[model samples]
Target: MTNLGTSLWLQPPRNSPIWQQLATTIQGLKPIFSDSENFEPHITLTSNISVNTQGQVDFVLDRAVAAAKCVPQGFQIHLSSVKYGSRFFKKVYLQVEPTPELLSLARICREDFVYMPEAMSQARNYQAMSAEERQKIDTQVGQRAAEWTRNEYDPHVSLVYSDLYPVEDADRRTIETRLEDTFGSGYDESGLGWKNGRFALVRCEGPVDEWEVLGVRDF
Candidate 1:
């Protein structure tokens, strides 16, 4: 989009079967929200890094690659639960169970891309926390994340996009109903399984086609 430094990543390779199942669920549920793009399995760590110019965007990615090279390339995390993120925006999402690796990586990215209050305000709708608030959440999340070793992770994928105003309960119910009808029925689950791998830096904002990869980072 218009914002700089916006990118998507997956920490580890997800099981094809589990991922497929999730994808199917997302596809079936897409109509409930604004159907823009097809769903792909990913855990979006950070989004919308503001860079006024293309050069700035490239610089950030280059630095991110260098910074990420120091860490190993893979880590295991559990997909724990499907929860509704109502605070930031009304949306249903799969929550990744907090892991030390995930938290560490997230913190590093946040620190590296720390922005001014104006920029921070722009990300409010995306993440409920402001830069200051995120620090606190990150600290607590980090502690809990560190304790996740053998435990199964709770990663909840969103099924619906909650809007500022939920027009009709029936409309919401209908969407949920459609998802259940499509996914609840026994469909071939292709991409649903255990996932562990590295995070790739797909693209940084520039010209849509002329984007740069920030390089993949291992957890």
Candidate 2:
């Protein structure tokens, strides 16, 4: 890795048989957002913050791995029915049921890698949340998240770009229904792989060198 300010993350490994199957299924679906063929499923841990040097990245990674090691291994999470976000409806998703461990891990990462105040200020909906509010939501689902869990964790990685707009309510519902009919009942539940956990810190543009390997971890 060449960049010092590379962001690190704990994500699912790529190249697993389960991921391959899921990707194939996603590619087969009519557009939901983007084909899963382009990527594998993974939960993002740390992001936005970056390591400035290769050595620094390595150190941070080692720390992250150690932090993750403290977490129990081989916990099973169920994949529930597929659901569509009415608000973010164009994108189809599989919601993950919140687990104590999952919530803890997410909280740890949030404390360490929260988006900077100025960074989020650019977004209209990105309001500055107090530490307390952040903590509360870290483990608890709000109204939208609660509704998502009604069936199970409908953890679908996006399948099309339908979330785009002006498709009438009926069309949106039709799209949502079609997605469930296509892959609603089934979900890929293979254990996460750590290899896909690897990512690079790159200049948001330019050459491949802009991409530098960072820390790797699994959800």
Candidate 3:
């Protein structure tokens, strides 16, 4: 597999009650699926950051630091619903409310990191594309990233990454029921929310299990 570059993630403070609850829930969910991987729960702020080279890595690190400095305090992140998707990473997860603060932070990270010169150059199939095709793909990439940053950013904390288990409506309901039994219903009622958190620059290369954290910044 090709390296998918880096991503900016918003992670709940490890010491927070919400974090502990999420950690426990993620662990508990593993047995329900035949093939599932354990992963740290987080909300992706921005993805597809170009960190193919040492210089690109350093550049992204600097941008992350700068972005972190923009928000001196932690912001609230509320869990709105328990949902499931076909995507491996989002197979089953908690949907986060699109709070203004969260959106603002996402925008900042996107502006700082998404359109780096290295982004287009490090495309997965860059070597196979003609110059014109590369330019077209580059434009598409930029436009998609911008659109996602501005209006389509869906924040969620993933609970499982299993290709074998497809979460249907019934399965989603069961999962929701289990979560409610474990952590109560709403974010307010169950303390399923974070008041503040940190940012991590993760190298999302290879398989999901192999993803590595390059650096972190606390707000």
Candidate 4:
């Protein structure tokens, strides 16, 4: 909750019948990742702006609203596969098939959105990084951001939103097994569907309860 940045997200309909079920199911799957608040199911468009404070986040949002209006937003998302990393605290999520409109909108948003950088130091705060390596990061963050753009962007809707990190191997396996049990039932068919219309902004670092819906738009 300490690091501050802004991001754009496309939220599925809150009223959708499967919405509650999905959140509840994820929490029940494993206790290590459970939360009381129901996090909004979203596909991230742009995130981790280099702003330092909420005031700056507000400034970015003001510019983002108009650009968001210019782009269309009614693409039907197809969740086709389950994906997870062996790394600790990495989330389990459903892979989204990138459609023409979705791809186009991703490109458009990157071009239109403003990310005014006050600082980029927080990104390098890791134990393994040497001082020289961290200094190198100062030059290479733009390259990293590029991964989230164009053909490199891997679009997926996260099923868990926990900040738990450096998990042990046995714990990781237990969580993975629970996820397999919960969502591995239908690999052959498109798993579940939810109508998407709106996009919102929130602090990506905090708990679900700490997240605030900064702005919303419908297309």
Candidate 5:
């Protein structure tokens, strides 16, 4: 990775059979956001935890793996349903049925988030991130610590542009219509039961769109 900063993600196996099904839907919904398909698909462990070295990332991942306490290499996850509805931030999802391994991964990430605030201060532009924004970030991180640590962890991979606006607009409806035409409504759980195998560390590149691979841990 070129730049050093916060944020680490869990990139799923590159050549997995599951990506074929999920990619099609994710690609089809790309008009909603430019960054949706700009980077390889992934599920985040910690959105932001400051660090500046590949060694630190690998160390944290190793601990996270150990904290997992001998879970299976591939976790059996079931996609509950696809929904396109009233939520502003979310437009669609391949809702995950959180298995033990999945929950453990999330829990460990929270318990031992490798965030050195002093290190983060060096990386982050405090000027750009206003006091209010910093507070919000702090509050959100605190919330995730509790939320993902407990059973309240609602793990779901987004299928569309999560930040897209116009929730009730005609354009959104058109997208929704297309979604219905292609994937159908919330009631269908046709595609489920995938074994999520392997994990990679991704450095936050630019924004939420571009991500650079730091390391991989195959278990």
Candidate 6:
């Protein structure tokens, strides 16, 4: 847990056509960017779950099982757009539509796993502050763990991690264009814009290539 900690992910079924196309797209993009890493495509449900002990690992796995059971099996997630961002993990990804099912699953995952001590400490301090003082602090901080816990459930299936590349806005635009041309603009016309998939608990620490799946369950 010293690194970025663990995450729960919704991974496309490996045998599906959508998975094949996404894997191909990710591999094809690697040669175009310098020092890019290959990674399994997944939409993070909830992240930054610190698991520093065997007991915590077991707790996370058990929670993942309980969360998966709360949702539908073989759920479908549709793509909204091919986008890029400055964050290393979100350099290039397919933005997923914020469907009710997706949002519900994210909430469930967060309720189960994201118990950061920073959030707890901040909550106690905020309770002692006046309304005006709390608002001032919130304005200064912009977004904190509590805000993220409530509303920041952005789902994306990353296709490339090009943090080492000198990627410009134009490069991102070009990549987006090429991806849309290849994958059909996130509308499922090319049969690659959606996934019937399962959820997994992943050890997403250190290097992206080193991330490991601890468990996977249908829905």
List candidate 2 stretches off by more than 4 Å.
1-10, 30-37, 73-77, 86-90, 115-156, 159-163, 166-219
Which residue pairs show collisions in model 4? none
TM-score rank, highest first? 3, 6, 5, 4, 2, 1
Clashes of each: 31, 27, 0, 0, 0, 0
* Candidates in descending lDDT order: 3, 6, 5, 4, 1, 2
Top-TM-score candidate index? 3
TM-score of 5: 0.64
Each model's TM-score, in the order given? 0.49, 0.51, 0.75, 0.60, 0.64, 0.71
Between candidates 2 and 5, the one scoring higher on TM-score is 5
- What would the per-residue lDDT of candidate 1 be over residues 1-219, giving only the tens digit for each residue? 243455535544444555666667767765655522343556655555555555665565556555555556535556643455443222666556666665665555554554332344555553766778777655654544344323423334444533434335765667556544644532223222254544555554544346555555443
> In angstroms, what RMSD does candidate 1 have relative to the true structure?
9.9
RMSD of each: 9.9, 9.9, 6.0, 9.3, 8.6, 6.5
The candidate, 2 or 4, that scores higher on lDDT is 4
lDDT of 5 by residue, 92-143 (tens): 6656666667777776676456433533456467558778977766665656
**Which ranges of candidate 6 are over 4 A from the true structure?**
52-74, 116-150, 164-166, 169-174, 185-192
Best by lDDT: 3
Q: What ranges in model 4 sit over 4 Å off?
A: 1-4, 30-38, 49-73, 86-89, 115-148, 162-188, 206-208
Assess the local accuracy of residue 53 in candidate 3 as a C-alpha lDDT between 0 and 100.
Answer: 64
**What is the per-residue lDDT of model 3 for residues 32-151, given as tens digits with 9 covering 90 to 100?**
787888878799987877666666666766665565556556477888667777777778888888876777678667755776345654777776879898778667666655677667
Relative to the true structure, how large is the alpha-carbon lDDT of every model?
Answer: 0.51, 0.43, 0.75, 0.58, 0.59, 0.69
Q: At residue 110, what lDDT does model 3 achieve?
A: 73
Q: Estimate the overall C-alpha local distance difference test score of candidate 4.
A: 0.58
